[model samples]
Target: MNTYDPAALECLAAIVEEGGFERAAQRLNVTQSAVSQRLRALEAQVGSVLIVRSRPLRPTHAGQLLLKHTKQMRLLRADLERDLQDLAPRSPGGARDEERISIAINADSIATWALDALTPLARRNLPIEIITDDQDFTQEWLRSGQVLGCVTTLKQPLRGCRVLPLGAMEYVAVASPEFAKSQLPDGLSAHNFRDVTFICFNRKDDMQAEFVARRFGLKRVSLASIFVPSSEGQVRAVAAGWGVTVVPELMAAPLIAKGLLVDLAPGFKLQIQLYWHSWNLESEVLNALAEALTHAAGQSLVA
Candidate 1:
């Protein structure tokens, strides 16, 4: 398009992220009709369809390109605002030079040791907002500009982003004592989980099954399972002897210490190496937060 319509590109991205024109309008504090008009104008300017209107909208490839560019623009704008505020000589406690740095992280990490890993930053008074979700999809939030940083399984960084390894998170197969005594076989093997039920965080969570399969050298977990979406509830169900589960070492540690759960295999473990992914921009806040995270990870995670 001859004219670079930042507002229109933003509206298009919101429509894709928020799932509807009306919702995007609400987010933009504008009328739904206005959002529609902006999309139509942009489509005419680009001479291509940007979206396919459905229950939850789907963006065309052209739309994704513009969305990526829009996100980069937003991140740059945030960095600029922070720099401008720094030049104003404003008070420290005020909003000057302070904008929320939204980050995506795994729920297990947030509820377990990761928060402690962030304690150093809190001690320094850094302002950050954490978004908890399945680690498998954490990178999506980065692409959508919903978060500037993420702890994700993807080793490589996303477009306009950089990645730094934060060290590995370990998980072990665990279950209630009663479940282990009753549901498990006399000598249980990973491939023999067909007889026992398993508790999973959600369909997207494959940690438990993957652990089993890897131990047995199988391609995948072929077992009966139950899905529990909540992080706390999943732990509770496993503790209640409803089924077996695989949980992070930090999450299972306290309960294991309290005798609420039993380790199926004392030494068997799965370690997922986490990385810090964020926009490759120079900002004092982001730089400070990154330093804090690196330092925290060094203390909390194994070398």
Candidate 2:
């Protein structure tokens, strides 16, 4: 088997994560020329282009494979650190930025149960990076090897990965009391839903349209959208009477009870089943994360 240099692999990962040679050099504490030289050596070793020189740096297929290997190495290091902590107070060098584990989670989950799930690990000073995207799209991070795991809507496990059911998060449509009184007095119905603006997470979010179509039995539905790009921001916008939004019932509950917002569709709730997908690796850190998330999710999400 041909062995590749670990430093060269790390150089590739740093370039992609930091977005440029200069930044990668700064992060790695090396000269820009050294970073470029390392990358050139790696590409020559692999006999393929490892990075696409785009507005934002992106990894090629071979680059992604190497990156994943690098991450697995990082996980192994974390395990070694934990095991050695009892014998030695601290490692000679602390965790590096390159060792930070990354995961993709939906913003709704992040705004609700997910942060609580991650609190224990964070408190222990586990180096982690949370990347938020729409739930339906989070699996792409796993597929691209950019993240070792993700909380996503995809039920099926990706190749070389394992999946665990995290239960369903219920979604409900909500608006401010004044907005409800003024724009949807009788609440959302087939007859009146089209009359108001719908606040969406982003252009990629179709939850608003999907809920309307499912509730009203429409073959196709279109909504007047105002993009918020944030889970909490969408609720804040709705409460300020900008428009209505569909949000996690967990987040909507306290506001609804406080009269800050009103449920627009009483009987219409959307249940989004969530799943946790992780690489099939025997890593203690990954297992601990899964345990924390699944335990917290069990308490909050609907079965």
Best by lDDT: 2
Candidate 1 residue spans exceeding 4 A from truth:
1-3, 84-102, 116-133, 140-147, 158-160, 185-188
Q: For each candidate, what is the lDDT?
A: 0.76, 0.91
Determine the C-alpha RMSD for candidate 1 after optimal superposition of all C-alphas: 3.7
lDDT of 1 by residue, 1-303 (tens): 386688898788778767898888998889999999999999999889989877667887787777666755665655565567556644544431124456888887776666776776555444556887888888988876666788888998898888888888888888888888877645358546788888888778888778888777888667678998776788999988788888788778888899998888777788888888888877666676677676777776655
Query: What's the lDDT for residue 218 in model 2?
Result: 95
Assess candidate 1 and give its lDDT.
0.76
Candidate 2 lDDT by residue in tens digits, 54-172: 98889999999988888888888877877776787554436688778899999999999999999888777677899999999999989988888999999989999999999999999
Model 1, residue pairs in steric clash: none
Error of 2 at 70 (Å): 1.0
Clashes of each: 0, 0
